[model samples]
Target: MAEWALIFKTAIALFAIVNPIGVIPIFISATDGWPAKDRAHTANTVAITVFIVLTVSALLGESILEFFSISIPSFQVGGGILVMLIAISMMHGKQSTTRQTPEEAQETAERNVIAVVPLSIPLLAGPGAISSMIITAQQSGSFWGHISLALPIAVVCLAIWLALRLSMHIAQRLGTIGINVVTRLMGLILAAMAVEFIAHGISGLFPSLAS
Candidate 1:
């Protein structure tokens, strides 16, 4: 039961951070003029990439940080800032510059395989998501917790694939206004999460300030 609860919380946090529904329009726009089959394939590719990226982050993020002599608290603070920026962008109904710049968008449109670029890297498995996973995994403290985290990550990626595969229908039904509303709600969630991360990191990094 505890493991399941942890998975549920991790899944919700990842889903909120990933915001697949919020990116439906962007996905549609990027795949514009592509055939239906290709779009579906692209969605699959993006989901797989997201799973790989996040799984790698969860498994090896700590080692990577240690290799660079970066502390967990430092990463938490930095990651929080990145997430907060993305959240602010979402609140404004704009894509975060950190996630995808205009140049990257143009390049993604020109590329034959967008699954590895804008769609997967900065779109679905962006820094915020990666950071969130690493921090969450660190908190796990047990082999089961770490192992359990993978399930939710895989499920969230699957959810992203489904949402993208049905982008056309979803877009039509939800419309622009609906999507924007969802974006703002997610932004609010992300903002609160970011603040929590920052505060926790600060307390850990500076024990004197914790009280």
Candidate 2:
């Protein structure tokens, strides 16, 4: 039960950070000229890419950081800052430059194939989402925990797939203002999570100060 709860919380955090609703416009623009079947294929491809990227981050990201002699506390601080920057951008009703710059978005629209580039790579599974997963995996600390984390990662990917598959309807229903509202709310939640990450990192780095 506790494991499932953790998975649920992780899913919520990841979903908020990924915020496919915020990326709908970008996806729409990127797939503008494609037929419906092609658009669906793109959505499926992007979701699969997201799943692979985030699953790898959850399972192996910590080991990679350790291999480079990077400590988790330092990572937390840096990752938190990155997530905060994304949150701030969302608050301003814009996509984070860290994730996908306007130039990248423009370039994405001109690309022949975009599922792997802007959509899945940075837009859906960017630094913020990767960092969040790494931190969550670290907290889990067991084989079962890692397995549990994988479930939520899959759920997040599924949610992304559904959102992209229904992009037109969602965009029309939500409109620009509604999307902005959701973006702002998700940003607020992400900002709070970022602060928590920074706090935990600081406490770990300076135990004496914590006392």
Return the TM-score for each candidate structure: 0.94, 0.94
Model 2: per-residue lDDT, tens digit, 8-85?
888988988999898899889878888999999999999999999999998998999999999999898898899999
Model 2 bad stretches (over 4 Å) = 102-110
Give the alpha carbon lDDT tens digit for every residue of 1-211 in model 1.
8778878878987898899998899799888999999998999899999999999899888889999999999998998898899899989998788887788888777776777788898988988999999988877877677777889999999899999999999999999999999989989888998998898889889999977
Q: Looking at model 2, report the run of 10 residues with the lowest lDDT sum.
A: 104-113
Worst 10 residues of 1 by lDDT: 107-116
How much RMSD separates candidate 2 from the native structure?
Answer: 1.5
- Model 1 clash pairs are none
